[model samples]
Target: MIRVRGTVGAWPVDLQIELDDQDWAALARQASAEPATTAAAAARPSGDDPLWSRAQALLREAGELEGPELLAALAALAGSDQAGKRLLVRLRHCDQVEIVQRGEAPLYRWIAQ
Candidate 1:
């Protein structure tokens, strides 16, 4: 399980994803295949940047998102760095997901099972 915590707008959200070793390895392989263009690389947050830290937190929480849904989530979050809002929208559109939350706050945790 990977645990991630960060803010979406004024609210804070936490994300967690459970993956076996094989799944993790597969993701690494896929990421490694992508072309590492300088402009594309620059778009991502640096380790020292606060936004990058937040993005990492969100990614950790997101776990094993794949396909178009994953692309949409990344686009939305990358556009505004609002993971919680982007997640809520994605969950509403996806048919194979389970979302859990504490009360009415924007904070939520989801699994794509």
Candidate 2:
């Protein structure tokens, strides 16, 4: 189970997602296959869900962003560096995103359909 609460515009947003063991297994399988997960990720609309869904929205909106920039955005949204890093790692493993070396930092690019 995961919980996230924040604001989108002037509206308050709160989200909680609970995945069963079977769902976890399926999600794990989907994660291993880039194409399948990428497609699944896109199907989820970015509403007010502040957990994994919002993390996806951030990367997708940024398109291509530097590590620091992405980190800062996540921190601002998630409220702490540690929380931000957790989301960052989750985003990193998502199929729609690719992290590459830009200079000394990594550039996160959102792969579009």
Instruction: Please list the Cα RMSD from the true structure of every candidate, rounded to 1 decimal place.
Output: 18.3, 15.9
Task: Say which candidate scores most in lDDT.
Answer: 2
TM for every model, in the order presented, reads 0.31, 0.54
User: Where in model 2 is the C-alpha error above 4 Å?
Assistant: 1-49
Q: Residue 52 CA error for candidate 2 (Å)?
A: 1.6
Model 1 lDDT, residue 20, Cα: 100
Relative to the true structure, candidate 1 reaches a TM of 0.31
Identify the runs in model 1 with alpha carbons over 4 angstroms from their true place: 38-113
lDDT of 1 by residue, 1-113 (tens): 89999999999999999999999999899878876685599865354755434534554577544434444565566674465445446544444443444454333233543
Rate residue 70 of model 1 by lDDT. Answer: 46
Q: How many backbone clashes does candidate 2 have?
A: 0
- For residues 23-98, could you state the per-residue lDDT of candidate 2 as single tens digits? 9999998788778777878966455655767777888987888988899898888899998898788778778899
lDDT per prediction? 0.57, 0.84
Of the candidates shown, which would achieve the greatest TM-score relative to the real structure?
A: 2
